[model samples]
Target: MIENVAALAHGFAVALTAKHILFMVAGVCFGLVVGVLPGLGAPNGVGLLLPLTFTMEPVSAIILLTSMYWGALIGGSTTSILFNIPGEPSSVATTFDGYPMAKSGEATKALTFAFLSSGFGALFGVVVVTLLAGWVTRFALLFSPVEYFAVFVLAFASFIAFGGGSPLKSVVSIALGLALASVGMDTISGSMRLTYDVPDLIRGISFLVVVIGLFGLGELFETMQNPAAAKPVATRLDLAGVVRAALEWPRYGVALLRSAVIGCWMGIAPGGPTAASFMSYGIGKRFSRNGPRFGKGEPEGLVCAETADQSAGSSAMLPMLALGLPSSATAAVLLGGLMIWGITPGPTLFSERPDFVWGLIASMYLSNIVAVVLALATVPLFARMLQVPFTITGPIIALVCVIGAWTVAGAPFDLWLLLLFGAVGWLMKALDYPIAPLVLAMVLGDRTEDAFRQSMLLSGGKLSVFFASPLPATITGLALLCLVVPLAGMALKPRTARSAAP
Candidate 1:
């Protein structure tokens, strides 16, 4: 703990530079624009800016990206409260009470609660990350190829079991990603396997290009198709109202703590912020003294949702940094960025690049504080941005997507691939297919395959290698349980319904 504190103190020195602070402010400002817009979410926003970071130091680039994420998360709540629209998926639950509160003339209080709770949740998550970083890194160092493969399996299975989507669809998405990852060449065999003589195919598909299309263009298309017609609720933050809300914050202490716990657990378990917010809201409704008044402009309900959402958003970084397992789509994009910068994610990352890791951890604290202050000060500005027509923003967003895709490798071929994947993304969204699993698989597929192959080599092709050691055995068993429990529940649900039929 002492060492981690010292490292964090040093990290403050690294992150407190003028250049880094400027990037944080710029990132947060840009993120507000992205979040206030309906289609361009944090994942898409981060993907759009990734090409710009190619020339930046890894630490600075990450600080910028993560700062943008915090800004986007806080900004998402603004739209939910003022416009009855969720700017981000995780903010959907906030609208349940947030919009109602605004409608009841408590817009300032609602926005204040959202921003402050979000700040608190983010702080809690960062504290958890600081405390667990060393332990998780040490634990991960003990993993061999067998254990690594099992861990990857566990990640995928956890998503299937708890992702709140069709397990079959998740499996299909993972399979597709793995296939995409296998396109260029077989690393061990030194021969092209999936390329059918096309020059572009020889380089394999770029996940960055895929992300740009899947999130950026895909969301633009979706938003254009179903334009939001809600007008912003006219309101301004008053100092008196803000002070009143801050004073009343302690009244919902139970909800905040409960939601934070749920958010952290869900984040580390592969259930992302969207799930965390909804779960927290549901539990808060059931357990709170004001349960019956949850959806009708309850401040505690808004607090519950916003707290969990930000907490999960922040805590999801831990798994991504320590284990190279991204629990959310945004984290998947960030993981891809790490690989692009030649910095491998996982246990070795802590030892090999302590400065980078600790700097990022330190920035989380500073960035969240900045995000809250900016979010609170600029709520009216972001709310006004909603008055802009989608017709204008849609074309601009589409253009940005095109430029982002082209910049990936400066290839026109990626532009066409972007359109193709944009259509795929739109189709998947229409079908309610989970995108996180697909993104995670695409980012980690090659590593997972290499780990499995190395394990096989070590075990002389014995399938039992995964269960030979206690660590691998435990991980593998958990993966199996994740898969089986979900399947078992699905199988039993219909029978239970039939037996209960009158």
Candidate 2:
């Protein structure tokens, strides 16, 4: 324990360097800007900035990226509270109570609770990363190809099972993502599956292009359609309200902790912050003493949503760093960044690069503190941002999205892909289909297929190999149950509806 503390202290030494601190602040400001703008979540935000870090040292680069991630998570709530716009997808739930608080002229109360909860969630998640990532890596080392494949299956299964809205839509979304992922040449067979005759298709579609298009351009189109989205609500930052909310923290402490746990678990799993925020909101609504008050400017709902958003955003890094698995689309982008920097994340990564791992962990702690302070201090500025006309802001955002996409490989094809995916995102929103599942599948499909194929090769194509080991069997069973439970619920829905009819 003492040794671990010493290592963390040493990591702080590395992270506290003048250069690193500057990068952290820069990343946070960039993230805040991205987050305050609708449709630019962490994945698109990080993707946009990743190219600029190519010239920096790997450690400094990651510090900047991760700090940007932290800033984006906190900044998302700002727009949600003040404008009823979810700056990030995960901030959707925050708008439930946050916007209402603003409507009722209690914007300061909502902002204070939201920011404080986000700070708590970030701290909780980083502490887990600092103390638990090594142990998590140690445990992940025991996983074989079969077990790893099962874990991947479990992730997808959990999303399909517990993800709200239509299960059929979720399944279709996953299929679409998988189909997109299959466009590139097969790594093992060295053959093409989905690509047309275009030479650019050989490289497969860039995930960054797709993400920026879907999140950035798609959002721009929606905002363009709705001019009312740019209208600002009146807000006041009452210090007295902030102090009262702080004193009332104990009242919402249990809910906060529960939301944090849900966020952490979802982050380590595949559901990510969107799922975490929604799930935490549901759970909070279920158990809060103020349940009836929810969605009508309820502070508890704000606590649940904002806390889960930050917690899950932070905790999503655990699986990425410890096991080389991305728990969310943003994490997938960061994972790609790590590989770009020649740092392969896995069990061996910690032993091979203690400085990088610990420095990142230490930076997370400091970054959260920095984000909270900055976010609180800048609330008035962000409120003014709500008044920016879409005509001016929309064009700037569109240009940024285009540039971000084109920068990936300097390929015109990527720009086209961005437009295509942006249209797809718009259609999905129009159809009320969930985009999260699609994003996850697109990011994870290749790795999941690779893991499954590797397991099959080890077993000489035996199907039973997936369940041959205890860990694999257990996880596979859970995956199967996830699928079955959802199906069963759907099957019973008609009968239940008939029975309840008048």
Best by lDDT: 1
Candidate 2 runs further than 4 Å off: 1-3, 235-244, 247-251, 491-502
lDDT of each: 0.88, 0.84
lDDT of 2 by residue, 1-502 (tens): 5656777898899899999999888888888888898767788899888877777788999999999998998999998988888888889999999999888888877888888899999898887777786688889899887888898788778778877666677789888888888897998899987788889999987677878887778777876787674555754577787788678776888988999999998888877888899999999899889888989999999999989888988988888887777877788888878877888778888788989988998899898888988888888887787688778888888888999988888998898889998898888876767776777777778878989999999999998997887889999999999888877787878466335423
Worst 10 residues of 2 by lDDT: 493-502
- The local lDDT score (0 to 100) that residue 162 gets in candidate 1 is 81
TM-score of 2: 0.93
lDDT per residue (tens digit) for residues 97-209 in model 1:
99999998889999999999999899999998898888888898898888889999999898888887677788888889889888898888878978989989988998888
RMSD of 1: 2.4
State model 1's lDDT: 0.88
Q: Model 1: residues >4 Å from true position, as ranges?
A: 492-502
**RMSD of candidates 1 onward, in order:** 2.4, 2.8
